[model samples]
Target: MFFHPMDFLILIAFGISLWAQFRVKGTFNKWVEVPTRTGASGAEVARALLDRNGLSHIPIEVVRGTLSDHYDPIHGVVRLSEAVYYGRSISSISVAAHEIGHAIQHKEGYKALTLRHRMFPAVNIASGIAPFLLIGGFLFQALSLIGLGIIFFSVAVAFQLVTLPVEFNASSRARNLMIAEGFLYNDEENGVKKVLGAAALTYVAAALISLLELLKYVMIFMQGDDD
Candidate 1:
């Protein structure tokens, strides 16, 4: 309820999560200064990739905010941030292509992405409910409530685990297609990798943090039960 031994590792993972966020922004800005050889804007790159994949029916929209780009599977649209939508830098193309990778995943019925979508609705509700359940259980010394919280929280953790492959697969698709479609040169591959890799670390850190906390809760629950 208060603190567990696993809290130490959770703190460490949380620190890594912060650093991963920082790394992604720094890497993006660093590569954003370096233009691609062809100097193609993100929107242009997205369109080319979409059309080449026979996904011309899907539309690209400019979304506001920094690094806010994503593919809307529900809407069947790709949204790019202003930086990725208009800039002609390596960061722009890499980010744009990554989102397009999600679009490709949607098109191909990637099992992980499909599972993530189906889990999202229930995970959303459970995630929101879990915190309150745990807090209230601790406050009232209710093992049943704690157990219920753990059950709900597990769903959220499972969702996070499922997300990892979806993200990695998207980055993999983006990198391969970026090279094959001539969006970036072979030499510039390092920059794309850095940008996408930094982004991937954030997800890894998040999943690690959640996993540690779930373990901590289970440990505490068992300790109390044994007592």
Candidate 2:
């Protein structure tokens, strides 16, 4: 039995994405609990940054889940995972500061972040339709449906592209704030860097996976149209 090239590509992409996620998670776990010399909990580190930035009113709450930490711009809340909220490691501090960086972006009206937020609705709509379009196109041999899938996936790709800057900037801000605010000493800074760098890999993996999936659909549609 012969397998389609597009199917093979998707399999490879999914495998790579899973591997990347595992690697990032391993890196995070290995570093997340190693206590920082300063003995500051993730919550303390987060509060310091927010206070320094005059965002003291913004609430930091622990939300249950692994790697669930994020800033909710609409509600002015920073949600940290239990591991991060209670951990007193350089990794925890770095992750906390990173979420706070997003809060800062919200406060300052960062253009890319703003644009990404605005595009969320369209991106969500596109994502909801993508799988149906792809499957329907294949089942019915409809090039138009596949083309629509490609278009929707393109919107998702754009959202991912916009996300790159927002994430990278947050990491950058996190590192700088950690140093400038004395959250991590010089030697401890490396640990923070490693943790944040590992986290960034997951995002990179996601974008790459999305791109590969988009390519797979394009190839399928091209083959169908040629038939």
Candidate 3:
């Protein structure tokens, strides 16, 4: 079953995702040791950037879990993990800047960010039910059902695609702000870049995986229709 022709695409996507995760973790671990010259904790950096951008109304909160940091657009909060919230390391500050960049996007009504937010609801529904629809279609030889599954799953892929720009723009904003604000010294830029670049790869990997899954489903449906 695993040796199906279409499975090759999935295997490649899985390999890419694994490498992305490894790179992100390895890069973060390497830079986590390097303390920033500014000596600002992640929360501190997030607060300063947000306040300067007139986003002082947004709150910064510490959350549990490793690499679970994110901005809650609905709540207008930037949430960081324990290490990021307290540690004054390059990884910490870089991550903090990236999250705050998302807050800035929300404040400025970035088109991609706004589109992503709007897509979230439909994407959520499609993501949950699409798998079952596909499985049922395959088991029962229902081409129409399979097509429906593909249509639903495509929304999720679209969401992931839209997310790429939102994420990359956030990182760009983070890097630019950090440089202009002198949050990092000349020598510290490389470390921050490594950290943020690694983080961004995870998003790219996610989008790729989603796209591959959608392709796999389409291939399956097409093949079955031919038979």
Candidate 4:
């Protein structure tokens, strides 16, 4: 369990994840200095987008973190980071629109997002329990326990896979909506794409890493069975 041939590939994916993280932060910070031509704050832009989509009932809240913004479907609120909530920069507008995109997805019943939401509870439990099961199975050389752990870990991997489409769809919706609503100028589209694209890379890298890890576990389980 300490290492395997597959560890090299997982390490490569991990490096990509780190690089994606670096790019997202760099892109966000760079765009944050470029003010939107409309001078609209992030919250204001989010409110307008929500209202335009006939989602006026949704409220926006300021949260305390950098790049920690998210839409809470249960409580039905959009939470924006402090920088994204009040800033008038391109980053602020891009992030705000992207989250509003998720709200719109919820309203429209986007299949991928809905599936992701449905998988959340089980994935949460499976992820929490999988590590212990796998560790114990390996220590005891129990193929059955390892198989069970693999099943649970696969659930988590599936969740990560499902998340990719949800994030990409949100970014797509945001770009189109941003253009149609005149939230960004024509030339400013590049900045929006850059910011959103960089952010999307993080999700892709995460999914890739999870997939590779899942494969590694499956291989190990198969080897144990053969032995």
Candidate 5:
């Protein structure tokens, strides 16, 4: 009900995140229609990359949802959205290869990827309880509870920060693998770049939004302590 300077930062972060989402979707949509020279579906591309990297056992599954492709390190499976799984478009190839990149990262034990996976449990717990802690602390004017909430939320923010490099590295690997594996030719690779680059911005925007939220909670906690 009350306005604070931090509220403006939250608004700005929200706007940036919204714009990032729109930009990624628009970029993906634009390139989704462009066909690849090889005419290989996303699933085929993923399989080739995984096999090329000596991960032949890793299976590619069709998942429901737009842009939902991801590599599940726990099960050692690559999940691709229906479009990316069956579509042979440039967008599909780029996204499919990017998810495969994560599989490769797991195989190679990339430090950042490993760290992010290790932090997942703690971050999940913190994310779930942070809001309740913040609300209860405010209602009861409990500085300690508020501080605990800030600390927990900070952990989640830290996880997001660590994710940046992991995602970037995955995209980088995807780009390199696409070229090396002949998934995309010289000019076609540019579309893949645009797709992956747009996808990367979403992660950056997400991290900024998380950091802004953490800052907001810190400001609230400080104000409560002052009072």
Candidate 6:
């Protein structure tokens, strides 16, 4: 009938993640529809920035989904969701700029982004196996399975750490570009900050959730041993 401390912590972490997701979603939605003063579409803003940086050859494509904007370095493409691609709102411009920031990082060979990209394949494989290892370990009372889980979770943690700098740098680049290029006026700068800041919280929440989940797995393994 007793539960480990990690069980409580995991539940708390899940709650926090859900709350943060909802809060950020609401904020994004509210701001994404507010029109920008310059009336430039998100796609237009992205093109202008890339062109200004001599990256006009990089393709910009509209992907389907909310908040799905990202740069595909391998394909040299910037993909934006319909909302972001067509919207002329300050939030849309900010999000679009943020994705372009990744492309800029790729073009400039930013160290953090390069490291994160190099780790992607390993991280993907580890993440794919992590749940299976952890759950199988708990179900079968196998130390080897538990060890595998720990190794996989450690890889995931490393990925999360690498992700922090890449994302923060992208947002920093987005904000600076917006100001330097006169995409945002003095009055609209705060709105751009708010949107990007809220977006960053989702990454923070994801990292925290992953860490707590790893702790739960560790606790489960220890309890199995004790039994």
What TM-score would each prediction reach against the true structure?
Answer: 0.98, 0.93, 0.96, 0.98, 0.95, 0.92
Taking the tens digit of each residue's C-alpha lDDT, what string does model 1 give over 1-227?
Answer: 59778989999999999999999999999999999999899999999999999999999999899999999999999999999999999999999999999999999999999999999999999999999999998999988888999999999999999999999999999999988998889899999999999999999999999999999989888988998
Task: List candidate 6 stretches off by more than 4 Å.
Answer: 1-3, 219-227
Alpha-carbon deviation at 2 in model 1, angstroms: 0.5
Model 4: per-residue lDDT, tens digit, 1-227? 55989999999999999999999999999999999999999999999999999999999999998999999999999999999999999999999999999999999999999999999999999999999989998899888888999899999999998888999999999999988988889988999999999999999999999899889989998988788
Candidate 2 to truth, TM: 0.93
The local lDDT score (0 to 100) that residue 138 gets in candidate 2 is 75
User: Per-residue lDDT of 1-227 in model 5, one digit per residue for the tens?
Assistant: 33668778878888988998999999999998999999999999999999889999999999899998889999999999998999999999999999989999999999999999999999999999988888888788788888988999989999999999998999999989989988889989889989999999988989998898787777777776787
Deviation from native of the Cα of residue 220 in model 1, angstroms? 0.7
Model 5 lDDT vs. the true structure? 0.90
RMSD of 2: 1.9
lDDT of 6 by residue, 97-168 (tens): 999999999999999899999989999999899889877876777878988989898898888888888999
Please give the CA lDDT of all the candidate structures.
Answer: 0.95, 0.87, 0.89, 0.94, 0.90, 0.87
lDDT per residue for candidate 2 within 34-146, as digits (tens), equals: 88888999999999999999899999999998889999988889999988899997778888999999999999999999999999999999999988987887788778988
Write down the lDDT that model 2 would get. Answer: 0.87
3 against 6, candidate with superior lDDT:
3
Off by over 4 Å in 1: none
Q: Each candidate's root-mean-square deviation in Å?
A: 0.7, 1.9, 1.4, 0.8, 1.3, 2.0
A best-first ranking of the candidates according to their TM-score comes to: 1, 4, 3, 5, 2, 6
Better of 2 and 3 by TM-score: 3
